[model samples]
Target chain A: MLKQVLAAGLMSALVAATAQAQTPPILKMTVIATLSGPQASLGEQVRDGFALAVEQRGGKLGGLPVEVTVMDDELKPDVAVTKIRGLLESSHQDFVVGPVFSVVMAAIFKPVTSAGVFLISPNAGLSTFAGKACSKDLFVTSYQNDQPHSVSGEFATTQGYKRAFIIAPNYQAGRDALTGFKSRYKGEVVSEDYVPLNQMDMQSEIAKIAAAKPDVVFVFLPGGLGINFVKQYRQAGLTNIPVLSTFTVDESTLPAEGDAAIGFYSGTNWAPNMDTPANKAFVAAFEKKFNYVPATYAAQSFDTAMLIDSAVKAAGLDHDRLRTALEKADFASVRGSFKFGVNHYPIQDFYLAQVAKRPDGKLQTEIRSKVLTADVDPYAAECKMQ
Target chain B: MTLLVVQALNGFQLGMLLFLIAAGLTLVFGVMNFVNLAHGVQYMLGAYLGVMFARIAGGFWSGLILASLAAGAFGLVLERLIFRHLYARSELDQVLATFGVIITLNEGVRLVWGSAPLELPMPDALSHSFQLMDGLRYPVYRVALAVTGLVVAGLLALVVNGTRAGMLIRAGASNQEMVSALGVDIGRLFRMVFGVGAMLAGFAGVLAAPLVSVEPNMGDNLLILAFVVIVIGGTGSIRGAFLAALIVGLVDTLGRSMITDFAHAVLSGPASSRVGPALASMLIYLVMAAVLAVRPAGLFPLRS
Candidate 1:
């Protein structure tokens, strides 16, 4: 009954788009995300954020009937590839939004782009694509993977940390993060520990962190890995060492981390507490609809829709026109300011943020200050976009 | 010296958790000749249950007992409803069915809990830290885990060796047909073993909830490790599982920590970074391979 009510509500909401469809039928925008499994929260945020954008636009994009269909990859690469193929075959002219997680996105990159569907990533701006593999067909509304680490590393250096330790899940993104940090941090990296990607328990690694006694600990754990690390780090009696991380302490995992995440310094491109009008509206709308503060994934996804909407207005369903329109980046971003890099990824400000207790006793991130302004990803230089 | 000790202690704590799950698995496999792939979900459920019960009971200790009871009862229900039917089937059939069970339970838990991880708070009494050395301090929760693991192992050994039920279990594991031919109700015995195994796995989950992030599919990775532990420990032998769990845990924990440090000492930073992570993943599988090569039936195969 509830699902039926939701379906009926969705139908009523899509009435404007449906009526507008009489002219040209429907302009479909398929969102591919992990709608199931452990990382479903991230996917849920993207789906909801995108839906909110569409709802605000009254289920239409650029005065055209827009039908948004979300597919669940279920955290499987094969499933994601299949979904992309399905979308390419069916909705060939529309923009495909998201399939988060750098690894999953990397799997379907070639097929989706080759099929001539405009791929807009809501999250996971993989560095591999940002550099040499830059494609003219793809646009990332999100910051490149290395942006946070590089900016945070700059902050670490400014704070005068001479000794540093790096710990991250043993994955491609993990390697990229540590490399990005080292590129900016001119310090003696005392040790580097790369555990398995799925590893949750890290007492041994925590013990090693204490033993090494680095001036600062920079961790690259995302999802549950970050939660375990933060919780155990506090338990290990190393809270004074000042751990810095990216993609770790955000709204999605902050509540679960509870007191452990308080005062934890992180580097991010977006925060819920951003004072910009667009950001404030997005957060307020998200809270009203979902009864929870929007995380970076949701914020970036909303930005993706807003960006796509700008291009759709300039040129409806024309690939070349949309590409040209996107390059102009005429959309009002929730991040206050945004621009496109040579590689088509965001050239945006990265900021230092800290987890703070709200007046209501809930934990949320407060942006401290801008760390890097108009920072294009380091790999943008290597990209010769063909 | 300090680093090594800490790593060893960490390894031991992890091994104890592995043994808790392995103890029940080996018993089920040995006695009923049933391979339960869904066992890891049992552990996952235990963690979730611990969180739920703790929240309700307002104490971790009460939550622990309640979670174990709930897990054990759930296991028995599963055995009666599904597993008993598969006992007469081949291992391949049992494996497929249990794998299905794993998927269903994983999805069910996800539906109930929502994909976000549920945090189980550490009891205030066990939330303190203990000084291991002059400069090194270990979390009191971890010390409690290690101690509880040891105590559980001891109590398990005592029950399996000293009690009549233990003798029946050992007899059944060695030769189920002969034990049944002696006029014992093998059905009842099988139910007991299955329920106890589930309870043990759940207890591990409950203990581990405060340490690891409790979420749906949390047990999937550990399932592989627990299987390796029982295989190395010699299936059907609790003593073997205990020994093997310790070795597997120590090697895994210490390998991840020391291998890179050792590599860096011998090679350049970049070279060590490349070699260390790759080697750490392969380290445990290497041990398992060596063990299988040396003792195909494991180090302490149950006598028939």
Candidate 2:
């Protein structure tokens, strides 16, 4: 009886040993996103992007067993700090992803970087981090928040728009937008007005814009504000002048704006109609899986996952080596050839995109022309990441 | 001068919309002592229904009527089923219950209408903009919105102060027991009050639908503004609501534009761009604080 029991135990032990030998170490990752409240759509896009990468890789990243834990930060900055801290302490993950809004990302910066986690930001690129606050542990898969606006400003200048007007919500991103516009455009700013983040009534502001009648109007109202502003602008009969904005009118908001958004122009890093295999494939699989167009948030997040996967392969799970591998961002991006600046933010191509109705009869972003072949951030010089 | 004229008209138009919402909110709270935080959902429902019906009936007028009727009916049904019980409950209970209703309705609307804002097209006749000044052209639809708002304010004043039903409502607001002792069907009156309040908010939603994006919780910020109007105007007083709403609206609209210009003139370009909006947004709240400090009760506190 003792011999028989020993044989059965031996067989099970062999099976366990073989399984352990095959799988080195489970790659554990914690993702924090603003998955609820006003910013839910943005968070959802990030989540899906990460999920798509995982699925395509046969549920593994870099050929290692992986576990992903996601937490919604509830669109609250303070709440994000707590969630990030909890994940760092409990999950013990060396890699962390997301929290889309700049405010939330800024709030959790200390905890995330302090914990030695590789903070892969899918969105929310702040100038603070891109410049003075840049950290070895921090990595952004998207442009520094100001770059889109900078590209648009440069595009505007190239188009010979002499007199310009800028409008944005009174927030960190908004200030950065205005600052970015000023960086490139050597023109007289006729008016630069900021409104409350939730200011719905743009009638008076629209009136002021009409009265000023700059050669072009630049705005940075994202989410619902974008839809409201565009519609109100149309209602005010201000369609004669060209409107330029970034993160304002896109696939997510274009549908909301209906016909009012038809002629709107914006600078972006990725659009569904980009003539690239990576973007085309990403869009097709995403539309098939989610039945909606992926926004810029999703594009960056997908890049983030792919970047991480490639980095892990190149550097293994070691923190210092991983950071080194990340700096050399060698991966095919949906927006095409990816390379990070010394600060760990992308220096990639940006396109001037216009809102146009798709052949499918839904409004989508159509790339008009290349804003730049490969753009480096203005803040990269300040990023002393050596 | 033209800018001033345009801004004043904008404020007046905004004020009228506030009064329409506050009229119903104040009357319901005044007589019934029911705190309905879900009142805002009625406004949202009105906009949603207007969009659906306007599309179906192929015009704006039919959409407005249908939305108003549907919203009033929805309010009446809710009163019969849920609010009737809360009337006898504690004030906190009423607030809590209504808050729950607000959450449920917001989610329900999102499920039904989707998160994308639906376009409610203005009738072609009213869609064009007319010259308010050489450079300033205002939409005829918006002018219609203001005129309709003014007319509604007048009708509300007449209904609440001069009419017999209005008198009963006033008596109930002042002394509910006395009205009940006089054999008034207070429950029936409660239904009427709730329905009318819902209808008025719905009407505003219908009117504002063409201008604003119609999405779930669109009434949320405006609801806060409506509450402020009632508080500043004096709860349960339509006259106070009208005056206060006008004050609140004018201050909110003109203050935003004027303050931005003033800040730009006083501060550095970038600094003013930052400070201008922050200060302008806070101006209304500052006014509310100042008004409350002086009045204690409100600008026109109702005599209980």
Candidate 3:
């Protein structure tokens, strides 16, 4: 009777252990985004996009219930580092998502990756992490930082422009913009100007552009800076010269920009009006839920959520298995066809998009033409991930 | 030559805006001996209120007056509730409390208006641009902005130097205890000064709304520059604030435009590319340091 009791107890314990293992533990995720100041709109889009994906899955990612913690980076690198360190110590997060600005990404990249957590960037895809510093644990759902700018460069070349005036905010991404534009444009760069990142008053810069009188102007000012620059640029009557830009004229700033941004050209990986069925569903659902037109930031973030869900579904809770599943990238992206390069950055199409007034009187980007197909980032070969 | 001409106008316009903001800040610092860091929020409130009132009043011109009045009323309310008690407190305490107010109001506006920027459409009269010179098409609204700023400065000069209230304010700035002993209601005078100062800052904001993006924390950057203006101009002198503001504005604008060429002439290509923009940003601070070193009492010290 004692032997029988022992057998029953051991069997019940084994059965309970199997049941617990099969149910899967709850997944923990931390989304660190710049959710304050002028760039807050971008972060809000990212957060909402990710939330939409999770909501569609009934608050679960890959059949496992997820508990998400969203933290604001405030667009300051130091603040981001402090918040991320506190986050790292407080909980065991399975995946870390976020950092809309490249500078914030540079700050939080190592700490999250070195702590053995997967860092999935929904927006910022800094070149520093795409090449030699690329980590097996880091995945980017967005195009490399230079790809969109390079598309503008190519577009300028195709338009038979012989002279270009380029300007960007003085920072790493700004430098990347110049390099990318120069790489494709065979035109004479009449002028290259880098303004202070927070310098809102661009009257002097506009005067300089007027003086230079380049055939085409390329600029990469983002957020509030873009809003001011575009308005001032139009007000100064310099619209006769075609302007090629990235991130400056997008859904995020179009509301304030209004008629000023109409007919302005930008380059990006995807636009709001992409013809894919998945994209259609996303744009409709995002607009329904958020009451605002979705930008590329939101699109990339939605892809990030889907990427995480697919990996988790295929690999369960195993780290190595999850990495392999993410590498496979077997999911329908809102961009239609999505795949990861060797460095885990996206190998995708780039398009030249023009800002147009939609039928509903909303300003948004409409795809003009494909600039590059199956484009691989220049830094992928330097990555040792393969 | 035309580029230079247009840029100088740009500088002057910017200077005019700075003067409007610094005019009030200097008076408060001089008369009340208060370091109200939340002065910038008054400018932000002006812009936000200007946008709202414009929507309601159905025109930018009417909206400008209503918003300025509203901002001034809000400033009076703030002074009564919080600032009145802090007049006897330490500068550090005042700073801390006002800083708290800045954060509270910034977040409050964000919650109320949402974080995206709002546009205040320029009136049809001044919406277009004119050829200031060859290759220089300047916006008419900006020119109007400068003219309005100058007119406001002139009116303020008349009131401060010409009126009975102006005499009391000057006396309070020099010797508050003596003015109180003379049976002047010093508290009421300070409140009036504070309200007028806030109104001037808001007026600057409404004028600037059409020229710049009206967003949350927009006033934060301008606030620092206003403080610099007041410090360099002499804490209480409106004339000094005007001259110093023009100097700061012209120097900042010209430095940004010409610094790259200067760097390229002096340094190698890559080095200049990096150093030029950095130096341009630092130019104003460097100017302030030099001025302070030369004249610690500022260019027009009220005490002197």
Between candidates 1 and 3, the TM-score winner? 3
lDDT of 2 by residue, B1-304 (tens): 8888898998999999888888999999888888989889899999999999998998899999999999999999999889999998999999999988988898788777766567788888898988786655689988888899889888878888899999999988988988999999988898999999999999999988877778777888888999998888888888889899999899999999899889988998567777778888888888889998989678777673
Q: Tell me what TM-score chain A of model 1 achieves.
A: 0.92
lDDT of 3 by residue, A1-386 (tens): 99999999999999999999997699999999978886788999999999999999999998899999999999999999998898889889899998898889999998999898999999889999899989999999998998999999999999999999999999878998999999999999987899987786999999998888789999998888888988998888887898899999999899988899898999999999999998999999999999999999999999999999999999987888999999999888999879999999999999999999999999999999999999999999999983
Per-model clash counts, in order, read 0, 0, 0
Error of 1 at A173 (Å): 1.2
TM-score of each: 0.94, 0.92, 0.96
Worst 10 residues of 2 chain B by lDDT: B295-304
Query: Per-residue lDDT tens digits of candidate 3, residues B145-218?
Result: 88988998898899889999999989999999999999999999999999999998888889898878889889
Off by over 4 Å in 1: A1-21, A384-386, B134-136
Task: Please tell me what DockQ candidate 3 reaches.
Answer: 0.72
Q: DockQ of each candidate's interface versus the true one? A: 0.61, 0.58, 0.72
Where does candidate 2 stray beyond 4 Å?
A1-17, A21-25, A313-316, B52-62, B80-82, B88-93, B266-271, B289-300
